[model samples]
Target: MTQAVTVRRDGDTFQARLFWWHAARLLDPGSPIIRVGFENGPKSFDDIWVEYDPKRSAQDQYGAPLRREHVQCKWHVSPDTYGYSHLIDPEFINANTRSLLQRARDAQLAYAPDGIGVRFKLLTNWRLDRADPLRQMIGTRSGAIRLERLYGSATDNSKAGAVRKAWRDHLGLDEEELRVLARTLAFGEATDTLDGLRDNLDVLFAYVGLRRIPRNESAFPYDDVVFQWMAQDRLEFDRKSFPAICDRDGLLGQGEGRRHVYGVKSFEHPIDRLEERCHQVLDLIPAFDERYIRSEADWGDALYPALRAFLLSAARDQSKLRLALDAHATLAFAAGSVLNIKSGRHVELEQRTTGERIWAADDFPPDVNWASLEAEVVELDPQRPDLAIAVSLTHDIAPDVRRYLSATVPTVGRLLMLTPSTGPGAQSVACGRHAFELAEAATRMVREARGSSPVAAVHLFVAAPNGFTFFLGQRQPVLGPVRLYEFDFEGGRDRSYTPSLTLPISTRTGDPV
Candidate 1:
């Protein structure tokens, strides 16, 4: 039997696991949710609402791409009266209930052709009391008569009726809208709590053959693991791509043939081999002196310090740290995508490399005139104009970059915009093949533009997956010098751009030198 540890609950751990649970559903290849995120969305929900397209596959999911469903998360160590009651009580609606309602109203309006319907869902760990009428009311699509019957009137004098009347008055909803609310509001339950998720994460690592970090030694590094996973996978992890090592059913001995096979034979050989593989991957994860893995040591703070120390050690020569840091950021962003928003940098180390190979397109698009597509160019007028190329993959090219280009450059050279077919105001990159084709097109543009004007340098403003960035660098047309700029989220969307690193172009080979 596997060891079971009673883990303590922390809010951060709960949120992390909740995020992962949401990931399992929304990030699944067949799921409709194309994007999701933490704590930075609509007013009411602490968790993000997602815009899901049922037709799309798993590769499309990104963080906070669109909004469709407002998810509110409520965490409790155990089932409680206040928490359960507050979910439905009108006065107890989350702080920004009015805003959420307004957004919902906008979605329902017929005048807005592109309007998307929004729904509210409360995710909780507590096993709901099915017997409770309010719980049942939220669980079902219809307004329950229990409250109405108990109170006898919409304006009943009793406390229950008063509460019901207050809720209706607060929402200012008519009968039809109230019915819509009953249908729109829903609840979802997870199998794990904070400690449960931590334990399972260890199991996940162990399934890949990694040794467990004892609970007493450190809280499970959920965020670090998630960052590493996203970075390594190029933000493409989903349920089918990355399944839980052991699910609730499997842990309960309910898995198909597991019980029968256990009685008939010893499967230690295969299990041992699998565990060995897990160990191999575990070896790749950077570990510190074991002192920093504490649960209370600033939630998810272990990775940065460990990464900094690793970079410093590897870049023993202080003079080489800048270049090393750039190289490290490249690998971390491209492979693991561990970007730090505040500093406008990617947070990851140089030592670790992903087992999975980064994606690349196999062939270029056969047909299509690359030159005909008007290239949006910026000329600084220094004899040979420096070419600035902005390729938008997951995010729309920031409007600020567009304004800057328009304002700084007097005349238009050429502009080509690639956007996602599915998302609004954004261009999407399909599998690596499409990304490669896009890169080839960019290269063609460079060559064509250089033929007409003496191009001295290239500056890239890319809002794309790190894999696409790596592939873009690979497919760059031969140029004298290339500088890439990282988007500045702090400066506002699509506005501020900062210099990241220069791609050294080889004059001899015409490739990234």
Candidate 2:
């Protein structure tokens, strides 16, 4: 929950720049090489370090530029080295999902000059059932408007109409049915729940992305995201191949000679659940028969982009160079072309380390005494306001967490949390040994609402081989030999071994100290 940095109007467009935990590429290599983690919390935008040419003065392709713009790195973990667990708020996740999908749409043609855009708004997600004004404020339309005023896009109404129309035609649904679907879409709910087709569902038609394709290469804007959806699932035609849809149902998997099989379930491994569900539902759709067997995607492979961002962030903060190795990112960099910009030279990048690409490898900040960070436990909730009054020690909260927590409580501004690294091959000490109240709460809600195993998503958020993240509702109080709060998200465990122990290895190689 990040408050948009600020807003400034430029001509017809109200110009504003905001920072999000997006999986971006470094400017130097220009390719999908290194992950550019936009930092949040305590660290100032300029202060945030990006391990690049440092010498390469690249343009920050932000929407609107203003004097002294800002960025904050929210909670993060190293994705390359190890596996981790995180607690996220389900309500927030639901809202976040809608926002992400909508943003993905808005940014579809973000790179296109005067590109046509589509804005799917979140009119309401707030619970009037809650009594708090602050929470209400967070979930209000005014808040959404404020956010939009600062970050909204100028979507092309005509384009949205065309895409919506194309999708309906591809599905062979009449205008009346299309209107019904459109109404449900207006509510900002997951389209998967459009018809409550969750149980005993049948094969269906869908699109990998929007109906329109870029006329030229300049539309690098939508290419990355749209292609990603394609890579996630194979394309198929309905009787007539007039157009293509994402095919969320196993309809394609049931069709003979069809090349791609889209996903219906959320599980990450064995594809057993998906396999079973596809079989059960295929018969429901009269057109799809049992003989239709297309290749099933691993499904988990699609999350790699987001995982790259998490991995890079964790590596940088935790000081573990190895986690970088775990992500194909180094490979993306190593194999991708690099830009010298000056002489137009391309340099190949190689991985230098990876002492331990495991889940739970080492500790970070070997010098920072964990005992001091581990203090008495202090819990916070919507009911308690004076939790700040009981505060004694002021461990500096990392800049990123500070911003996110600031959105939670006023006290967050006053407290300094002892922070740690987000490297791989280790666990985040945040919720000591995993009974994270906030994380577990989110997991339960996700399981109940999604009717899918929370373990797959949870592992995706905390584990490697995929992108994983948790909400970690504003941190809780810490107590014991190792402060609970200190460990919460700190890369101490992973970074200590990687950073402190491996530094000498590089020095021994006689590389520049």
Scored by lDDT, the top model is 1
Among all candidates shown, the one with the greatest TM-score: 1
For candidate 1, the lDDT comes to: 0.40
What is the C-alpha lDDT profile of model 2 across 1-513, one tens digit per residue? 122222111100100011101111211122211222222212122112222222322211112211111221121111121100010122322343332223322232232123211122221112222332212212121111122221122332443344444544444555544333222111111111111221111111111112232234323222233233335552211212212222332113322221122121111111011221121111111111111112111112223233333333332343322211212211122111111112122111111111111111122223332222222222333333222211111223334333434453443212222222332222333222121222333334333422321211110111211111111211111110101121122231322111000000111232110
Residues 161-265, model 1: lDDT tens digits: 554554467567665565444434445554454565655544334323233557686655554455444444434433343344223213212211111000000
lDDT of 2: 0.21
* Cα lDDT computed for each candidate against the true fold: 0.40, 0.21
